[model samples]
Target: MNILHHAVLVKSVNITSVAKLLLDNLLRHVREHVASIGSLSTMTVATLLDPRFKTLGFLSRNKVQEAVRRLKSECTALIASSEASLPHPSDAGESTNNSSELWCLLDETVDQKRQSFNATADAILEVEQYLVEVNLRRHQDPLEYWHKQKHVYPYLYHMSQRFLCSPASSVPCKSVFSKAGRSSANEETAYNHKQ
Candidate 1:
């Protein structure tokens, strides 16, 4: 949609005044409706995650930054959630010494915090690298690209599956239903004639 909006939205076009006015009105209405539906975070994230169309559909770098920030936030949340859901190991047999055990707990606390901080940093770097890489070929499938990259970016692969797997709008589904209904009706008419 964003691509289409920018495609013909240039003053360099040589159309007549009346034609240009009609185009301006059409662009205005399309922009208004797209803006209304553009608040969806999923759409933003999906566009960013798509290897073929990453950030190209966005109007500005700030918008790209916003999407990247949102992706990182969700990535962090997913990391934290997975850690919380994991089974905890049973406590070891009673410690032989109290002094070491007291300090070990403190060490574990520090280690865990450091690990969490590092995890977030690593995730941010991953997002940056993904964005920096050139877009995949238009003929390539985003999901397939992600699948091949799963080992390199497991978190993003999981996320891309969640976001990119579904159709963005209902239009495709509606068209499919309409076509199916017409085909079924035609088949019924043919069957009636045969009988």
Candidate 2:
């Protein structure tokens, strides 16, 4: 984001004609291929969940809201599906007893179902709360925030898991071979100097 911002906004007359042309071409390519940060819902959500970015880093506010809404709906659907898969307490036996055991069983079933819905609601609430809070320091690890608050916001944390696993930037990995080659050459040169 900073790179793109500076690329366009920081132009000076000191730049040569060739460099200006190159900058324009680069901007064109970036606009064509890498302009919209919110195009991918997963990426946008991941950025939103990042402590450094949150909703504040979004280029488009509408996209941030859309991603959050999508996540909330997905969480609600997951809760509903899991609740549907559970065996009903009444299915255990057709016998209706006024016994405390029956009441306890029924109460447990209701509580479980309610808790599922409440969990989803809480997850959405957590996101909303996070959005309102001050952005964390850029140097702080966003995953650490997620880890510390996982118990408090399990649903959001779980939703963020898949997105978090994705590579944020491939530059480091891409440069590994070049870095290795440079280091090996330096080591060989040092060995020759000692000979």
Candidate 3:
């Protein structure tokens, strides 16, 4: 099938999968970078204490201390920013209620789907926090964190484009699927009537 036809058939697939992929990749990149930094720090500390490396002890000690300070600052900022950005569960109740009402007005059959979507959104928010926590422990630089996050922007943009073109429904996928199904059914009926 052509691209457009394939897109129609896959209407039920959530575009958020793209976002999730980006988020996961970003997290993994950050984690690996942080791990490398941690390993380097350990090696630096180890070298500084080695008797054979005493000639370089003073310089190595200073370098290690500087690295530790930088790491600490990065960790603090990451934790603080993540905590600030987290979606409070209390807010979910209000937003969920509003979304549920909107979905009910659009299609009563999709109330459960709307709820599930909200739940998934909440879960993603939580996952973001968890990633922050895991990465913060390693204490990488803020610039590096931003750099890692930048990789996901294109994916996020693609997901946003899909979302924008999508129909207005409380449950995003359900709404898109319903619209597609309706259109196909109407086309089939017209074809039969013409016959």
Candidate 4:
């Protein structure tokens, strides 16, 4: 995008024509494709989680707000599902005649619930605060950063885990496929020569 902008400022006919065409077509394609990409909640969440290009530095205020809301809701759902999967106190025991023990059990359960609730709220707050910080260095890995900060933002960290494994681009996949093909051909040739 910067290259195109600079090319447009040049006083050369050849560069101007090419840059104009590129800018026009590329802008149109990007606008259309970006809108469709925004529809993918997972991808949007992943983009937001990426510290390098958090919010893509271009998403509108409303769009950013909507994405944050969606991320928080998804994180909340995951938290709820995980907690539901755990054994409940009532399910773990039969009613007993010991009132003091029952009171202790109830108090512990309540404390646990409150702690989880506080943790979730803290995670959301941390995410918002993180958004205000300067972007990560270009060389830094967001996965590593998020992984290290998991304890600080447990829910967001878990939410990021779901989306961060995705390949950032198709170039690496194509490169791997070509490398595999070459290795297979080399192995086949070697086997035929030996046989």
Top TM-score: which candidate number?
Answer: 1
lDDT of 1 at 125: 80
Candidate 3: C-alpha lDDT: 0.40
TM-scores of the candidates are: 0.72, 0.59, 0.19, 0.59
Candidate 1, residue 38: the lDDT equals 52
Ranked candidates, highest lDDT first? 1, 4, 2, 3
Each prediction's total of clashing residue pairs, residues at least 3 apart in sequence or on different chains, is: 0, 0, 0, 0
Per-residue error (Å), model 4, residue 84: 2.7
The candidate that achieves the highest lDDT relative to the unseen native structure? 1
Q: Give the range of the ten consecutive residues with the poorest summed lDDT in model 2.
A: 168-177
Per-residue lDDT over 18-85 for candidate 4, one digit per residue giving the tens place of the 0 to 100 score: 77786576445544555555556776677677777676433467777887787777776677667766
C-alpha RMSD of each candidate structure in angstroms = 8.4, 9.2, 27.3, 10.4
The residue-by-residue lDDT of candidate 2 on 55-105, one tens digit each, is 654445666678778767766765566666877544455556568578778
lDDT over C-alpha atoms for residue 157 of model 1: 87
Runs off by more than 4 Å, candidate 1: 10-12, 85-105, 167-195
Q: Candidate 2: count the clashes.
A: 0
Relative to the true structure, how large is the alpha-carbon lDDT of every model?
Answer: 0.74, 0.64, 0.40, 0.66
| TM-score of structure candidate 3 | 0.19
Clashing pairs for model 2 are: none
Q: lDDT of model 1 at residue 37?
A: 44
